[model samples]
Target: MRAISTSGSGLVDVDVPEPQLRPHDLLVQVEAVSVNPVDVKIAASAGDERRILGFDAAGTVVRAGPEVTGFTVGDEVYYSGDVTRQGADAELHAVDARIAGHKPGNLSMAEAAAVPLTTITAWESLFTHFGADAGTTGTLLVVGAPGGVGSMLVQLAKQLTSLRVIGTASRPETRERVLALGGDATVDHRSLAASVKDVAPDGVDFLFSPFSEGNIETYAEIVKPFGHVVAIDDHHVDVFPLKSKSIAWHWELMFTHAIYQTPDMASQGRLLDETARLLDEGRLRTTLGTEIADFSAAGLRRAHELVADGKAVGKVVVTR
Candidate 1:
């Protein structure tokens, strides 16, 4: 099994033995996987070099554990894998069935792999944390709308919510993409507070960002009183200054359900299923801007560089 891995020192591609399957796991023959910022952060930050870095994956089931009833051999599945175990960087991965969902019939493997991580983040941030109104007349400010999670956030907001959708981007290309995806307005994050003020005279109802620091304070200034903030990255930023706006801050980590083995671990599976339906219905699409072949040291390195530089407008996928 050829797979990319991060050792205690650096990332490398190696041929490792296939993984062992647990009673509730599925042995999947991975067809495609998507790279997110979390993968790079883990590779750079983890002290262990043996760490396998990946989260979003879609593949065909080769074996199903005895207790798993959600899928069978040959079923096409997609999932945002648990962070505690090895990932789907290899041709084969033993993944928990509880976190897997049926892949949509209309999408290719690369497209399917892009949905889990970003969709889960957007869904959790908007509904679970901020309690966005799908029918509200308020505004949604998706800062950096060209990002992996941000791209999907715009679609879900437009399709699932009536709230006015505003997206921020520094490039004209990204702003055009955002508008094409149903963004009602576009702002330049480089302009910071001025951008937000120009787009929203009243204020934003929700502020969603997956990018790092420097924009939080400016975001705080544009949000309406009682507006909610949902951040998905490990910005580790301070929000004490936002108290005056009476703003509420929320953090979303897609790995939470599987990482904690939450009682609703199966809920992640359910969310992906819903996303599949939405995709086939033309209500949602993948944010994958780049696609590479298989997990190798070279491929993983390129993926890491894109995320680390914050130049990726959409998710990057690796295909078998």
Candidate 2:
């Protein structure tokens, strides 16, 4: 198997023997995969160690473990493989069938590859952590909403809920993209809180953070007294700022379920299934911003570099 491995010093493309398939696993012949911030962090933090760096994968099932009954040979699937497990940056990867889902019929493998990671992060951040009612009437503010997860979150929050979506993007181009993706309105992130207040005078009912900067206190100010705030990044914000307003704070790490092998570990797959239905119905869309062919070490490095610069909107896909 030809895989991209991360050595202690840097990433290297190597040809290693294929992995064995477990009873509950599915052997996927990866056609396309996407890179996330986690891949960049792992690559930069690698110290005298080698790792396969990738997360979202979409391809065909070449073989299935005996216990994998839902999918068989040649089934197209999309999933974000577990971080602790071997990733999908290789010719072949054996993923737990419980985490992978059937690919949306409407999208190409490259397009499908872009969804799992961002979709899961956005879905979990908004619904799981913030207790957002999809059917309720209110306003939702998505910080960094033009990025991959934010793009998906905007569409999901709009389609599945009555909430008027306000997404922040500092650039005029990004703001256009956010609005095109279903944001009821768009605001420049340079002055985020005030920009949002202009859209909804009362206050935003829910605030979702996908950006690195901005204080939680600023979010609290724009939010209503009992509003909910959730972040997906490793934000080290002070708790005191949120105390006075009685605002709820939530942090979402998509890897937590798989890393801890949580009791509802299979829920990731369940959500993918639901998301697939939305895609096929033309309700939700893929966030693939760009595609780098070959899925080589150099290509992966380029993708990571773009993401680390913190300007990439939507998702970056690399095909093997």
Candidate 3:
């Protein structure tokens, strides 16, 4: 099998044996893959052993294990594979059936590949962590709203919840993109606290910060008393300062369920199924901005470089 494996700080093409399937796994013939920040982070810390570095993948099922029931051979599926296992950066990949979802019929392979990791993060952050429900009337601020998860967050909040959506973007073009994606208002991220206060004097009801680190104090100030703040990024953030306001801080990691083999591992699949329906109905859209035509080591290395720079507007996908 042809695969791109991490060799030190970069990727290399290697011909390796196909993976062994588990009782609940599906052997997928991968057609497309998306590069994410986790890929770069993992590559940097990887040891001498070659590591496959991808999670978001869209492909067709070639075979399913005896315990698999969700999909069959030739079924098109998409998923962010479990982090504990090898990734989907190869011609053939094995993924747990419980975490896989049927791909949106209207989307191409590359488009479907772009949806899983970011969409899962956004869905879990909004619904699970922030506790956003339909018909809720309040202001929700999405910090760093032009990136992959941020774009998905903006659209989902606009379409599903009644919360007034405020997105943060430092540049004019990114701000415009946020507005087009259904943000009720856009604020300059450089001037986050004041900009948020200008829109909601009392402070926002919910805050989703994908880039929360040094700005923890600013977030504490802008969020309402007893409000929820959901963050996906890993950094040193002191929540003690937010105690005065009674603000609640939540962390969302998309890999938690699968990594632990939780009882609700199947919920991830359900979430992706719902997202696929929304995409097929045109209520949601893909954030695939840059497409790399080559699916080789060099192409993946370039994609990793762009994502690591932290300036890419949307998801980067490579197609076979």
Candidate 4:
């Protein structure tokens, strides 16, 4: 099987053996894959071992494990595979069926590939951590609203909840992109506190921070008393300031369920199925901003470079 992998010299194209399928796995012929910040981070720490380096993928199932019930051969699916295992960057890959979902009927393979990672992250952050639902009503602020997860987060919040969505973007184009994704309003992140206050005077009920390093103070000021703050970054933050207002801080990582083989791991598959239905119904849309027509090592490297630069407006996908 032909695949791209991370070597000490950097991303390289290699021919590796087909992945061995587990009892609950689905052998998929990968058609498209998306690049995320995690991919860049892993590649940076690459060792002499050649490790496959992709997470989000869309493809067709060629074989299903005997225990699998949700899908079978020939079904198109999309998923963010478990990080602990070899990834989906190959001509053929194996993924646990419990964590994969049927691809949205209306989406192309490339578009579907762009969704899983960001959708899972945003969904888990907003619903699992913040406890938001269709009945939930309040002001929710997204700090990095034009990036991949932020774009999906803004859309999911607007589509599934009664909350008022406020997105923060520093550039004119990015602000416009956020508004188009269903944000009620957009504020410049350069002056986060002031800009947010200008639109949400009473302070927001929830804060979604994709980059939470130096913005803790601004978050402390912008979030209301008893509000919730959900972050996905790895940077250390001092939560002491939020103590005065009794603000609850949470960290959401979409891979936790898969990594631990949690009892509710199947919930991610169901979540993706629901998201696919919404997409097919036109209630939501794909965030694929850039598509690399090539699916080889060179093209994958270019996709990684774009995401690592931190300026991409939405998801970057590499397709066959």
In terms of lDDT, which candidate is strongest? 4
Instruction: Estimate, for each residue in 31-91, the C-alpha lDDT of model 1 and write its tens digit.
Output: 8888887788788777875877788999999998899987999999999898889988887
Candidate 4, superposed: residue stretches over 4 Å from native? none
The TM-score-based order of candidates, best leading, equals 4, 3, 2, 1
Pairs of residues clashing in candidate 4: none
Residue pairs clashing, model 3: none
- Badly placed stretches (over 4 Å) of model 1 are none
lDDT-wise, the better of 2 and 3 is: 3
| Collision count of model 4 | 0
TM per candidate comes to 0.94, 0.95, 0.98, 0.98
lDDT of 3 by residue, 63-112 (tens): 99999997989999999999999999999999999999999999999999
The residue ranges of model 2 lying beyond 4 angstroms of the native Cα positions read 212-214
TM-score of 2: 0.95
Return the TM-score for candidate 3, rounded to 2 decimals.
0.98
* TM-score of candidate 1 on Cα atoms, chains taken together: 0.94
Poorest 10 consecutive residues by lDDT, candidate 1? 210-219
For candidate 4, write residues 163-270 as lDDT tens digits: 999998888899889988899999988899999899999999999998888898888899999999999998988888899999999999999998999999999999
